[model samples]
Target: MTIHLSKSRLKYLSRLGLFLFLLILSGLFYASCNTQSSRNQSGKAHLGESPMTDSMVVDQLIQRSRSFYEETGMRAEPFDRFLQEAMEIASRHNLLWQQVRILNTIGRRYRDRSAYGEALRYHNRALTIAQNINNKGLLSEVYNQIGVVFRRTDDNAIALDMHFKALRLAEETRDSFNISVAINSIGNVNANLGRYHSAIEYFLRALEYADRLDNTLGKAINNHNIGECRLKMGYPEEALEYFQKSLAYNNQIGSRAGQSICYNSIGAVYIAKDDPVTALEYLERALNINDRLGDLMQVSISHSKIGEVYLLLGDFAKADDHLNKSYELAKNIGSRFQAEESLRLLSRLHEANHNYATSLEYFKTATAYRDSILNEKNINHLTTMEAMLETEAQRNRIYQLNQMTSEQLITLGRQRLMLTIIIIIFVILAVITTLLIYQHRLRIKYNNLKNQHKLLRSQMNPHFIFNALSAIQVYVLEHDVEKSTKFLTDFAKLMRLVLKTSHHDFIPLKDESEILKYYLELQKLRFVSPFNYQITIDEGLDQENTFVPPMLTQPFVENAVEHGVRLMENQGHLDIRFKKLNTQMVVEVEDNGIGISSSIDQKQKSGINKKHESMAIKITKERLDVIRNDIGGKVSLEIIDKKNINPFDRGTLIRIILPIVSQNN
Candidate 1:
């Protein structure tokens, strides 16, 4: 039916209808967004200098980056401009040391981007440059850089070897920077190996350099690292002190990234202290910064942390909401570490609520991720080597093929074009098949490794740092020149290790043992021979062939003296022993101190007065998982409570079992 209406009435009806439609559409869009504010979208507190709209865009970019990772994997267009720039810098600079330095920088860029293949290429090129220059100093630096590549690729053994080389180089140069760098690197390697005492000594030494050089950044990093290591070794109060020092430097620098990390770390400490509100604030802060930075990696972690806090707060829906976000982000970012960690938090949360089936499902997911990451890390190493070899062989073949006369090649090209097509088809098909299989494996592996790393990188907590300077200050004030000299020398050596090894995975056993022995001697001087301690190893254990996780057993020994043995009224006694087993080594740290209780482990978990591991034990466990899974070996940990389990045993019994491989292997 058609009806003619007055022009004024028709226009009025049209305007009213349009207005109604607009209102309804706006309501629907608002509902879809859950009414999120521009600032809240990034989940950050509206702190100074943070704009709402800017935060929203950052959140959007973060989402986009995750989507990008999911769609394109880690295959970002290799910043060819940057690589070329570095190459040009290397070439134009006649100094081989400068070339090595540039190459190392390029390698680090690739490493940060998770492009191990490209990183390896640059690192190897740097190594060649160092060799050509015959600069032991550059060689040492290259070794350390190569170790970084190994750690990234999950070869802790090789990583340690390179770190050792760097440490030796540092010693040769007598340069405090390299010495500190090398020492710190070694201690970190030992810490990763579960030698917390060694890690502590190394960090203390690093503090010395940082102080000597007046390097606030280095000091803060080392202190933070030490606190992180101590948290694993079960020293909450000490860890917090270290973290505080770390924060001071980070604050002074006004580094948003460092601030975010410190906030999250502080939150972990608060959580350990049993404060959820503060934890949430810090986690949210970290999440906000990570979102703005388009760092899904850190965001996923913050999400999981928030989920954990919510779960503790008994908010099921809230917990699930954040956990789901975490999982989705982890999956989207192709970070198996985060996904697995999210699954774990979900598992624990559900299990606590008596949701066994759901818990099992989540647990299964976590396990799968764990396994997948391990495999991927392992294959990353092998595939990297394979890719390089294949590229080289192909290049050589291409060069040889190119050498033929132009006419001969043209005739050959025409004649063999058809036959070549068949062969090419077959080769292409085989390659595609292999790649498909490889990709499937790679996907599973990458996700798995991501989950493992997610848990380890959780913010610092209940941190600790051992300050040699304070002790030295005390000695100097007391006019104890002999003690001061000895302490200073040990301090210098330890600092050298920390500066060198902060970035490594594992270090040579000989080097680690040397540092540990030195640390023990220094501590003995501080204690004025309160008790004598012996570090005994079986035949062949000292060889570079036998390697352990960084900083595994040293802490328990230190704890015996610091908390247990030294507290005693009588003379203290400690026993540190190491024995190699078939493909494994058993390390025991026993002492005469106040006995351990059955509830100690549980107390440790709750972050009560008991020793706190922060994420140290978990990190070492994860790093070991990385090592064992990558190397086709197994690693295990056991802590023996002195009182309940063994009445006769007075102090703590810290046992470490490590996989033993031949030097070549």
Candidate 2:
């Protein structure tokens, strides 16, 4: 082993050692390359032009784009640039998941801008990619986003179908977040369809899911939706409670948009309660928030709501200013619904000020806008239906292609026969359902008409006629020719007015006001103690144009005079104020007399039967309910016992809100 060697042999041995070292280095380099190739394949970054090494760079781009989309308030210019860059990176690296995400974000941005067609295209592309990849979670998100686009386009039926599909997929994959989103979307569709109870039910279910998942944003949105449903159903008190809860949650989460919406809802509730003074405070807060957020649509709504409050408060100048601002903003933003609402309010304001020509123009413009909205909805519905039909045809063709063998062909023929039979059965069922619904609607209409007639009979009570005749007879017997002549003339006019209006359901507010004036004057002549009476019509009321149910306010007015004012020890005072608030005619009848409680106490002590008074009020309530059903407007009565407000103020204040019944209807 230690044998001596020549110099040439030693040099050859050293060269052999160096060659072995170089061989080992080359093998290690090949192993590293193989490992990188395997990682690229597993990461799905090997399909495109860019190498796997660029995936990290593309991923960073996607993250930056997502952060921009979430953090920035949809600043379109910057967002568009970022999204385009991200999309290019994802495509270059063939990042399928990132592409899907980027596409969805673009779709949502288009949707927020109300570009429905563009939104649908992007979402559908994302949906196709998700389907190709068999990604259930991504599919659920794409389906939900597509449903929102359909909802915004007014294809509510299709929207609901899409959301249900999303819910099914999300549930199957146990995706809590997407499940909550789908449920909330379904609720919105129901609400848009005017199924308020159904909407609330869906929203409540969504809230439960959100609570389970501890999703603060989901809970906030669900609560807000529930509040909107309650408001639509005329449950203002319940709506207020839900809105407050939503506001709290939004505040905790620092959602400016949610907070703005909650504030607007709370303001609307106050408006409905006829407290315009308080309503303005909340509406202004919403306006400020929306302005800060640069949400033009929301700002328009806030302006409109504030205008409505000002109108209710009899500040026509302020009302006009705000409504005009709302109109301009809505028109600029292409918000047809808000623009139409503003136009309607403007028409009413002009009519109230006796600008008939201008009012007519505005009314016509509002009607045109409304028709356009309806047309848009119809177009969207037809488009969705066509799409559905095309999809069905595609499915049928796929079924045909799948059946190639003789046995399969025979099975296909049998399936065709079965499908024809099923179609016939469905048609029959649909016809039957249609007939049933038609019958139900007719029955409801019949009941409403019958109730309206009953209300009319109650309004023209025989006791009221007898009391008027008795008062006139006393003036005749006194042999006071001047008083007797005036009494007979007024009584004849009253009878004629009643006869004229009794045959119809509604009369102009001006006519109703005249009737009250004559009736009150006659009552003053007959009363033993002198009382002061004043009737004030707000400057913002369209007395000649606005129509209301005949004799709606007379009963309350008669009650105030006979029961309340008559019982007062001192000279009584009666104040009647008429104003228009939103779509309603608000009549406030106040009497500084013995309070209703004291009057009832005296009556009970004297054992006087007051059945007629209760009956009159009951009939009035029923009449209001009928009007509400017939016209789709809210009618309410609030009787405020002044003693509750101030112990020394002894009287009853009756506030009646009558819906402005359309004369054309």
Query: Which predicted model would earn the best TM-score?
Result: 2
lDDT of 2: 0.79
Give the Cα-based TM-score of candidate 2 against the true structure: 0.51
* RMSD from true fold, candidate 1: 53.3
| Global lDDT of each candidate | 0.70, 0.79
Total backbone collisions, model 2? 0
Worst 10 residues of 1 by lDDT: 1-10
- TM match of model 1 to true structure: 0.46
Taking the tens digit of each residue's C-alpha lDDT, what string does model 1 give over 210-328?
89988878887898889888778777678888888888898898766777777788788878879899889988988999888776778888889999999999998899999999999
Task: State residue 217's C-alpha deviation in candidate 2, in Å.
Answer: 0.9
Candidate 2 Cα errors over 4 Å, as ranges = 1-79, 379-665
